[model samples]
Target: MVAMPEPSAPLSLRHRLAQNLRRLRLERQWSQEDLAERSGLHHNQISMIERARSSVGIDIVEKLMAALGVRASDLLD
Candidate 1:
């Protein structure tokens, strides 16, 4: 199993993105499949992103932002 980071430890950009993505998705009442369909990505891709198991390119980020009706900064910061 993968180890989880300590709560006190600062998250890396990838992990921060993952956390924010999941939060935003949930706030919108969307499942991974829903996000994937809206983003034109596969559900597996969304899962990987939410888990921080995949490094996303700017194009993918743009897709997600558009699908989620959020800005790039919302996902990053």
Candidate 2:
């Protein structure tokens, strides 16, 4: 039987982005649902993004940046 490889640690960049995104949302006192409504995205999607479980798209990033009033670089940083 082929053994499955162990999972590696999550990327720091992704983790950092997740942390930053959550911080930004909390800074504005916005819930995932609130941010979802503002960004025209699903709350589940926002949850996935914040958890770094989903790959972020440019469009979603733009929407988040707009909704959160932050620059793309700021969030990614």
Candidate 3:
């Protein structure tokens, strides 16, 4: 049998951004629920964002950053 190449990681910007957001939030000692309330987004939405299962808009990103007292660049890191 022939071997297949390894699957690549997600290439979407949203997925990458989500990963950064999750890390920042955790570093700040905030739970998904806390981030959701502070960001004005739903808990599931934050969960989905962390899981890279959903897309996010710039506005939402800004809101989350503001609530977390983090810069947008931080979330993009």
TM-scores, one per candidate: 0.93, 0.82, 0.79
Clash pairs detected, candidate 1:
none
Alpha-carbon RMSD, candidate 1: 1.0
Candidate 3 lDDT over residue span 1-77, tens digit each: 22223358544666567778888888989899999999899999999878777777889888988888988878876
Error of 2 at 26 (Å): 0.4
lDDT of 2 by residue, 33-73 (tens): 99999999999999988887778878889999999999988
Clashes of 2: 0
**Candidate 2 wrong stretches, greater than 4 Å:** 1-11
Best by TM-score: 1
TM-score for predicted model 2 compared with the true structure: 0.82
lDDT of 3 at 26: 88
Better of 2 and 3 by lDDT: 2
Ranking by lDDT: 1, 2, 3
Minimum summed lDDT over a 10-residue window in model 1 is located at 1-10
lDDT of each: 0.93, 0.84, 0.80
Higher-scoring candidate on TM-score, 2 or 3: 2
CA RMSD of each candidate after superposition: 1.0, 5.4, 5.5
